[model samples]
Target: MVFRSQRLSWPLRKGLSSVRVKARAKRRLFGRMLAMKPGMKGSLIVVVEDDDSIRSSIAEILEMEGYCVNAYPNGLAATEALKRTEEPCLILLDWMMPVMGGEAFLKARAELSESNQRVPVVVLSAVSERAQGQPGVKSCLGKPVDLNRLLETVEKLCLSGKCA
Candidate 1:
């Protein structure tokens, strides 16, 4: 698993239509591209979701794959954490939560200092419409997210060392 770090290739950036091809590519490319900072092992991934099971599952999966994860029950908690940590390499953000929704968090994140503003974000939501055209959001994943798809997207975004 490559640390979610770089701009994806064109086909991947547009979205990989061929799962078999992507899987093959993931297998072939992942080893060569594990580019996390030395001693860090993996880049940081922030997950904000109100659903405890969903948040825990995502965090567990990411951790199993070697990424450092911080899971939050709401955007407000995540925002506070992000402010203190290194600009995360990637954020897996859910659309709705009690204290602060993803939109508010995105807006708040953008308003943070220059470095914070550049952090890459991927929106995960049940409402497809609400997930579109979100400023600073690199991609969207529908709820009941396919684990493979989520992994692929994470690899595409993070493996290349291009994340802010």
Candidate 2:
């Protein structure tokens, strides 16, 4: 009985280990990057999302495309980061988040001084609602957003300097 139990457990343990290895590899590929340090240009982009995997993937993708990325887990954290930058920023905002939702961020952002208010926010949410009319929102992207569309929107906004 002991030998039989050991054999069964061996296979299960092997399978579990393989799964763990794969997950770790995926994270290593897309989850490790340095945050934009102080004195770095504020013209860089800011990604605000609650999901760790989603935020890491987006930050990795954008960074691979040569964009400087600063990812935050919530709107409040991103807002605090925004206050420290001297230059205008491009923001990719998630609608639902703890510690201040995207809507509140937009409102608070609008109330900020002119320098901070210049940051253009692009909403990224699973819902299909448009964000065109929202204060400080330049556009909206339905999630699981397409990489091409995301890049295009960023380029258009970042290159043209048009957030209003």
Candidate 3:
């Protein structure tokens, strides 16, 4: 019995037009409860990225992988959504943005949050400074973010319920 993450199961459906593949993927995702990505039926991912292309691309990739992802133009939007504490099992936040950059947003969130204070955040940015010795961030990806690494972090944090 091979235990795989749900993120792997969803993408298999795209290339595989066969009924067997779809069934197998569904079975794999449901049966392997221990390796499930989120707490509920669908996991939501929040991405605070100013770059439209990068944000869309990343969101599309995660969505294809079966995770429900939301992209924000800046931290404020993502932060507002975070207050609801509904979507996004994890957050992929960019270090730089026009208003309320990642650092400020993070600080504000920490200060204001009564609960959901430990939301996992992965710093996806072109700047290396944010990644180096940055506090309260789970992971960091340099510019031209690596898709594999991003997915890995998402899967790990979403599953474990803690930022690395």
Candidate with the greatest lDDT versus the true structure: 1
Candidate 1: pairs in clash: 3-158, 4-158, 5-158, 5-162, 5-163, 6-162
* TM-score leader: 1
Per-residue accuracy of model 3 over 1-164 as CA lDDT, tens digit each: 22223222223434555466547656665565446434632577888888887788787667656677878999888788777767456878889899889888888777656555567778987794665555557788787676677778888787785421
Looking at model 2, report the run of 10 residues with the lowest lDDT sum: 1-10
Rank the models by lDDT, top first: 1, 2, 3
Q: Write model 1 residue lDDT over 22-109, tens digit each, in one string.
A: 4655565455347545433377889998888788878866775667788999999999988788777788999988999998998888
- Backbone clashes under 3 angstroms, per model: 6, 0, 1
- Please say which candidate is ahead in lDDT: 1 or 3: 1
Worst 10 residues of 1 by lDDT: 1-10
Q: Estimate each model's TM-score.
A: 0.73, 0.69, 0.71
**lDDT for each of the candidates?**
0.74, 0.71, 0.70
User: Model 3: number of clashes?
Assistant: 1
